[model samples]
Target chain A: METKGYLDMDLLRFTTAGSVDDGKSTLIGRLMYDTKSIFEDQLEAIERSSEKRGDETVNLALLTDGLKAEREQGITIDVAYRYFATPKRKFIIADTPGHIQYTRNMVTGASTANLAIILIDARNGIIEQTSRHTFIASMLGIKHIVVCVNKMDLVDFSEEVFSAIKKKYQEFSSTLNLADIQYIPISALKGDNVVDASKNMDWYTGKTLLQTLESVQIISDYNFEDARFPVQRVIRPQSAQYPDFRGFAGRVEGGVFRPGDSITVLPSGLTTKISKIYNADVELQEAYSPMSVCITLENNIDISRGDMLVKSDNLPNVEQEVELMVCWMNDKKMNPTGKYLLRHTTNEAKCVVKNIAYKMNINTLEKIVDNFEVEKNDIVKITLKSAKPLFFDSYKRNRGTGSVILVDEFSNETVGAGMIV
Target chain B: MSYNLNHLEQLEAEAIFIFREAVEQFENPVILFSGGKDSITLVHLAYKAFFPAKIPFPLLHIDTGHNFPETLIFRDELAKRYGVKLDVGYVQDSINRGTAVEEKGLNPSRNTLQSITLLEKLEEGKYDAAFGGGRRDEEKARAKERFFSHRDEFGQWDPKNQRPELWNLFNGKKAPGESFRVFPISNWTEMDVWQYIKKENIALPSIYFAHDRNIVNRGGVLLAESPYNTLLPGEKYEQMHIRYRTLGCMTITGAIFSDADNLDKVIEEVAAARSTERGNRADDKRSEAAMEDRKKQGYF
Candidate 1:
């Protein structure tokens, strides 16, 4: 509640993926309540709903089940975004359902997250759901992951059980590519090692979940090596006050750019020098990844939306045929023969699936090369050949420019998302 | 090597990016200004979004005829100051045309009718994108909304089929006769809005600050004494110094008893408040899925 102390605080956007019985909602409720973020009226509403439903105790899960269908079915059908703030940082939790059927929802939540919190029941160790969520997180290039071994109270806070789960998890996760993984033992229901350090687990000497969330090293998560600026709009204020001001309006996708930096316009290959960078009225000396600024170039090259600007020395791969791992989101089947609208950053083009490399067997991490039928929640490595060449980098190199989405041309629904290989 | 932005700055940048995206993506875009703090903050963000040039779009206000006089004054002055056209689609017009009927009850506020009028005007103007000031943290159903939410030809929002909004890539592509309701500040909370308002020193309507008004408490929800509301058998209006946490139709937007007369005090009070900002809104108390139902019918 103290604004003066930490008004200028960074934000951390993380996603929580857990099974039905993992107490994921309870864990979130505990965090919000302990942090004094659960408002009184909201708590009362939850209490009333719990009482009406004849729940033995206050049902914290009621707080997250937003839609009528979700509350009726007692499941999270969509991603629910919740916000909380500590004096140190502001947190945005993209709470997603963890059932196998809700993989699309989890993918939606994981896309924007800097970190992913995979909740594993202490008794169950590492299960299929765990690997699915973890694989999705790693596939999405989430740099940090926190594995909360929930329900430590049921295990009597035994360190051996925690060690076994950790061992099994580390063994299974060794096969996958994970950047950072921290295991914590906690009981979301009994409030152990969630907000404060666990008193029950004296042997475990790790920071509480809140501490980890607040102090996680996320500054290096951004791709600053390659400078990619996808021009979303061109600000041409042919006005009397400072006429002939043509600024390329865009959010810096990656790297740091300064005035006088020589940049190349994609597709056209025209070269220009940055004249100025403006964030609203104040002129910025330099702009980096994710900052929405208007940049002016010295050369008046014909540029519009869908055109990209990058450092001339460092260029991106401009290719018409691109291979990527596509995650099918909609119920409609992905048609390899039909053309779909492929959108990458500000660029939109028509593309058709050239070939399906293989399908990922989530449980075994095997490749199913024979099966090419892509259905809902299916992640397949496919090659798409667009009508126009796309300027992009690998998904690992730059998430902002490398990622793309496929939309159904007729239905206008975003059916698939992909990471450029 | 250090490139870090505070939460406010990050939220501002995100909002500005969204604004530019909507402007560039849609052929015709408009900002749905409700004269509330959220919409006012949205307008301020729009100004920062297209800095040297004026906002590329006009502002649309669905006037419910039951407005606070101060709100209309503030709304007109803001539009004039920004040098943008202010288009008002009156609910009374819808009523006159028999397209919308007024609710017959003790509290027959025109809050719900604004949606119909809004859809009519948007159809009339052929606007493809309507930017709203709705925040996810405000209501339960809104927590699941995407940045660029699509509406069908009937202006119906099918929550089950929302696009998967991943990363910073927002797909604003839609067919003809369909419009998108885009919320730039989807990640912002009530506290964040107030803090940004204070940090930016943005101007707000006088009703946001504490002032004496004739208010009637109906079922523990304080409703200002306006022509739209009729006094019950035993209910009577009493003078009270109050400030509003949100602005809506004066008949339904409940006022809280407070003395927070300035932005600093308001933010301080908000920080210490126990109840949620929307706890006082009587409209939401209609049903558990009130917001979801209204949103499905294209309520901004």
Candidate 2:
């Protein structure tokens, strides 16, 4: 009734990658059910549809397959978001397809995720799909990976099989830049080691999947050493009460900011002190990463949208030429000499592909420099020359200021996504 | 040291960020208001976003001419208090102008006609972006919607061909004639909305609170007896205490039996309720994919 405690919970965003039969939807359904997030009307509607399809059991996939074509094909065509909450944390799941064709979609889903869950079937241990998902997760800079060995009931909850799969996965992913990798044996269909402990596998003493999700250390996931704020808009309330109130409004992309902190404005190199930081009328002493606040400078300086505010001591690279790894998303082949719109942070610039260095072989983690052509679902390294200098950092250092999206001018479609190298 | 924001404060901040983005990118934008709690909350956020100055965008209300009287009163009062411009598009004008025709049945509702009126208004006003208060957690099909949903020249939505929206960087690029429907509170759920309303102390229409009214039962849904609603052969109007979970054309919207007259009681009822807020709408009961079909044809 009075859920006062729900207000204080922190938010956790995660991405899930699994094949069609990996019971990914079933696992999500169980999570919602166990947390009492699924309403009765929705459950009844899914049940009615399941009965019409002549399913032996309630098809949990029906809950997430929102599109008509997706339900007819019985496969996830794109990313679908699902929300649930435990008493400890609020979770947002970006459910993505594991098929090789939908690699772009998986990347799109994993772009904003702090953690990734790679579902593996117990029968097929450490397969190519597992490697492909892990490689993409690492490329996206996901710090946490949870390898869920699903359908353990089919293997009689054998500890040897679990250990073997875990060992093989570790050996394969030892080169990845992941900080935390965990293994959990689960049976989504039978509800084993998902939300509750499994009696069949008493040998496994680790926490359940939900327990791990709720207890993960995510506050340190953000970079708190460098302060970066990309000015989104200028809030000028030209009224009588505050005639000259000009506030720079934006969300803090990294680090912490406080009043009286000396800051440097990029591209113009103007320096000033933060006069005040306001979050809807309440003056905050400090603002950190992901907090949206309006800030006023001590002195009036020339600043506008598409500019960056950073600590004068620690600055980012301000350059006109940038090297990046891009994933082509559009069906049309990329034009080698084509000029497109590159949007990064709050700035948009006209950019052209300078050179195609190499294309990554996702399956083998090999770099092929012979091919210069870029097509759909192809990840390639390219150098770009922008019309104006962009303030950015490496994608590995901070995801907020390091990512860019390319838009086709003619079609106005987002055709490519790039991470600055 | 780092400080964490509460859930309500976080949602509020995210919504304000989206509002500022809409104003900065689009040449002409308007807020699609329905005098409901969600839109009211949006208006409040807009006020906070550009404080000391009026909201840069105008409020667009598609009037079906079959709404509750209290809703209209509240809409006018809110516009005056906030000093924001209000634009009303009438469905009856479309009907009289031969642009839209009424359905022939025992219970004919103007719910579907709002789409035509909305499109006509957008074309007439040359609005490049329209802000809606639609949330993803409201219905099944909406769960896949992006923050910036693209619309064709004809105002039709192609769900399969939507652009991939990643991170906070929304791709709002579009052709000249094509427009975008931006949802600021797309991530918020029903519970989140209620909690925000309580925390912000935003005013809502009186119809949301419990009151005595005349009602008639139709296919297990309690319909508020209004002038536009025609009773069936065996149905009769009876006095009952009820409140609306959602607001729309009076002919199609259903009221729930509740005793939650205050905000606290309403929150408790919402927390314990089993059905979704949209479960009581008679328009959605027309088909399983009613919302999806309507969304494709450019209905908010």
Candidate 3:
């Protein structure tokens, strides 16, 4: 493998979501093994574990079931991050658990993923888990989805079986707002069409699973129209050398910014001009989304943490009362008009539940209106009134500026993850 | 506009964002330094996170009292170069104070005993957050760790009861007595760390490069000779030109025989290497659940 120009390679982060026996772990194992990402020691360790468990063949699932309880029960309880790199792009797989009880873990994993791989067992076709995971993936603002029809070997690698599963999945996914969807048939255990092309199913001509992952166009995933920078800290060097240095430190959440751009600080409604944008001691000509840089405004203003810097005219909605679709994460059910802390970007406020709009029946994508009792792993749409106004857009507009996590006051556990409507 | 960041830039950007979040969330924070490459990379990112301004947090080293001599000098120089405070918590001090009992064995390692000293120092300093150089790819137990990992009042990690972290928005809220062990580079792998070190031209300890050291082979793992470890019968230190893959208490860390003395050669060696970096760690070799057990007891 050539190491030259390896520094110029980009990164792609995706997640895998499915039921317990959908061969998610085995698929990941095949990908890593084919790409030579699994080290010899790790394979040896898992081989030893497989033998100790009295398995006939090496259990690839043991690679991700890292926790003691998980290993004992032979199930993945939490999100296990796996890494691999092709010659073109590096990949980060947020392998989330797929049990219904673990839906919250799936939501957590999909929040930062650019794409989501939803596995389908060919024998079972599109099950409830297939739709439930798809709903969560689309709800979390993931634009790309790859439906991997796994276990083709179990189905005798029939072309009719693959097409039927794809058609039904497409009909079910029509309700979601996913941008791009692709289908591939493969058997994770038999290494069919995972890394290399499969000869077993020559009738279906398509890119392999690894090819789809490596060739996915993810450059247009981030929102680049509205410039939003929420200040996390104010860097001020008090020393004698360049004593008057004051810059706003933040990661650009959306759009682009350059020196002399007219910027407005949210909640304060103060306006200033960008004098310089410093990316850690080195000044840059332009800064875009996801780059952590310090911005120096022309006028010294009272801009502090929780203050957002955006384009003067292209402003986000500043509202005290907001509607959100939240995935309940904790066992402690949400109370009526419950007071919880809401964190958005760099700012946070004490927010009360104004109203519960509806709860989603994840399996059928139906709205349950009458019963408002929310439990863990339930997706509910609710309205919130915060202590202060939050500058934001709809979740579909920009994921970075449009997401919030609700923290329980007494327990301090992240109880709900929300996206603005 | 491309709106694209290379893998290195992307990792750097994510780490810097996390660093600033800790600065804004916690009242008092410190970087848990070990004079290793990971901590060294952490320090470099923190410096860039708050450029033009001095690093806001101090460096806290839980000294095992058995360290590479080169690491000691490098740690002091790094502290001075960054103009940050260096706070050392000595395991020997904990042992002398009777708070921690040292192990009595043929090959006694201070690795597990450092937890007692670490918790004591965190309590003594009343630090609300301790930034560590923990990467998920390093160990299996760490693979599912949260970026802002919470510790109880006793500084014990409850792996099963961790809060769900979503997106870049980290929930750092905690009770009054509880503290957090935050890992900014939890997503980076071992290869990413080495590549970043080379890309940024970051300085590391001399032990990381190829050097001649007197080491003894124990169960196929070569351990460098130090006063902290005693040799078994028929065991003698042999001169070998080897380099350390990881740095810890000199008694536990193992070395590999290689001639990769420079950055390019080191990256090349790491690329074609077959074993995990922590495969040589005696502490992890104790059991499959060793890292998890140690993490539960407040080990970094």
Candidate 4:
């Protein structure tokens, strides 16, 4: 369905990451300010804060980096989300940190992002931080990449420098598992090629940041062909108002769910029919991907949370062994023998790292063979065997069901993010 | 065409997703209901999220003895109506136990002290996760908060070290004694809430609509007359047509000068409002990052 006030178009969640002083915040602030999303009061506050900070001009970076320490240090410490809507599409910008220590935050921010905007300072071109952010974005399996060459103002908006940086980044990015990539040079500080076409850079003709964000084809982003629905909770009131109302409550992770369709609950291997689809009051004929609704079955079956409801034919792999690429997120060293709470779809079971295949050299895009030791922010390929069988396909096939997070038992922190290979 | 899912529907779906994520992740979860519009909306979404089945968890309210008599009544009625368990933590108990000290002044309020009672209650109940109707659009500090907000064992929120929330897949895993303050309606703005209330025909407290109340003008906000609040020197009480942008205690919760009594009117008024809804709340005006500062100390 088309969204209201969004040119009746779909919504997109994307992230921007780069090293410190790369203008990530400036780009986001430019987008919000140019699109008229930043309210008057918010602008006034920023102006006031800028004045208090003894700056003559407003610092656009102050918008996303909200923490006091971050503001003082002039770096993003944690991911800050900023929402803005254009006529074309609604956007949620995950402004992630560029520092090495906050790599886990970048991984977290990019996990759900459909697109990744990796910023490269035009003067410095592609550096170690750029490679790391790009690799992390690629490792997260983000389908689209928008390379923003920021601070073109400092480079006198030179096309040669832009093209050189673009070429260098393209060569480096070629090593990662990226589907689509686009590059644009802009001055986030001067508001060039952000919300409007930059007049200064006539040689480089490309859509503005907002235009790219809105027009980026995301209809194909979600896997609608493969049916996968993880029952989050069960709705059964047994009240006199709606007696005998039993429904499986959850969002459609992937695929379309229609009423009167044959479905099977995974692991249990029970067959049933989707008798009805419900979103609050109305009962619908069909409900598709990303829409949260409750589905009632014609045949009563034993299904609960951590169970999957999918099309009978397009079943997920129900095996104990899974080959995956995981980005370790904890400072505490990963223990291959340690028991991790593996959550895939809704099903969670104990899993152990069976083998460490290799770790990716982000800069080189080479797989370095290593022992099964993954430290913080290290992206490594591994084979995992869970205590219980998992029902899932490759992440490329279904981003919804194929992704997982490993929670450390001792700390209970989400220590690792994994994608099925 | 209404074919486009209304904002309410979108908000509802998002809340349901968050609710399910919390229930599935946390060991013991509770919805913090203050009988306010936001909390009311939260309970409504939580109910629909897991329909037919009883709400998976209980509803907790850290009550200050100084409350709008109506809020407590609404709290009990709602709990009975839904057949969900309700837990009430009292500020008076905390004050009596010397866990929290009561402030004495013309504008004294238990708003800040409620945190102590809340933390104690959460610890006593061993509740690992609490669903709060906290929207980022409500305040400056809240605007920067994560959907699955993490709080340390001391019930402190380190705004600097928040976990990055990516997609719909919420990672609710946290350290011991640390709880996740799940905000299902984090994206819904104040106008969106009123619109949803109007669309869903959700009943709110009587104080939400314009009513003639004996109020005193204090710092550009109308403070309702109550034993909880005293008339300070150079302040005189007078009847004023006022309505509440938010529902809290009679002391700290400020009344806005508005004639828009109905839900649709309220929506329109909110859509065109200048300052934030929390701007009138004096407790937040203490500092630029007062909310953040308080949130760091576990003040929900």
Q: TM-score for every candidate vs. truth?
A: 0.98, 0.98, 0.99, 0.91
DockQ of each: 0.81, 0.64, 0.81, 0.36
DockQ, cand. 1: 0.81
TM-score of chain B of 2: 0.98
lDDT per residue as tens, model 2, A127-199: 8888889999999999899999999999989999999999999999999878899999999888888899989
In model 2, where do residues sit more than 4 Å from their true spots? none
Q: Show the colliding residue pairs in model 4.
A: A235-B51, A235-B53, A236-B51, A236-B52, A236-B53, A237-B52, A237-B53
Off by over 4 Å in 3: none
- Give chain A TM for each model in order: 0.99, 0.98, 0.99, 0.94
True contacts kept of each: 0.78, 0.56, 0.76, 0.32
Worst 10 residues of 4 chain A by lDDT: A1-10
Fnat for candidate 3 (0 to 1): 0.76
Residue-level lDDT tens digits of model 4 in B135-240: 8767756767877888988989987666545456677877666787888988876656776777677888888889899999888878888887878789999999
Task: After the best TM-score superposition of candidate 2, give how far the Cα of residue A178 lies from its true spot, in angstroms.
Answer: 0.6
Q: After superposition, how far is residue B6 of candidate 3 from its true place, in Å?
A: 0.8
- lDDT string, candidate 2, B21-95, tens digits: 878889999999998999999999988876645799999999999999999999999999999999999999999
TM-score value, chain A, candidate 1: 0.99
Pick by TM-score: which candidate is best? 3
Stretches off by above 4 angstroms in model 1 are none
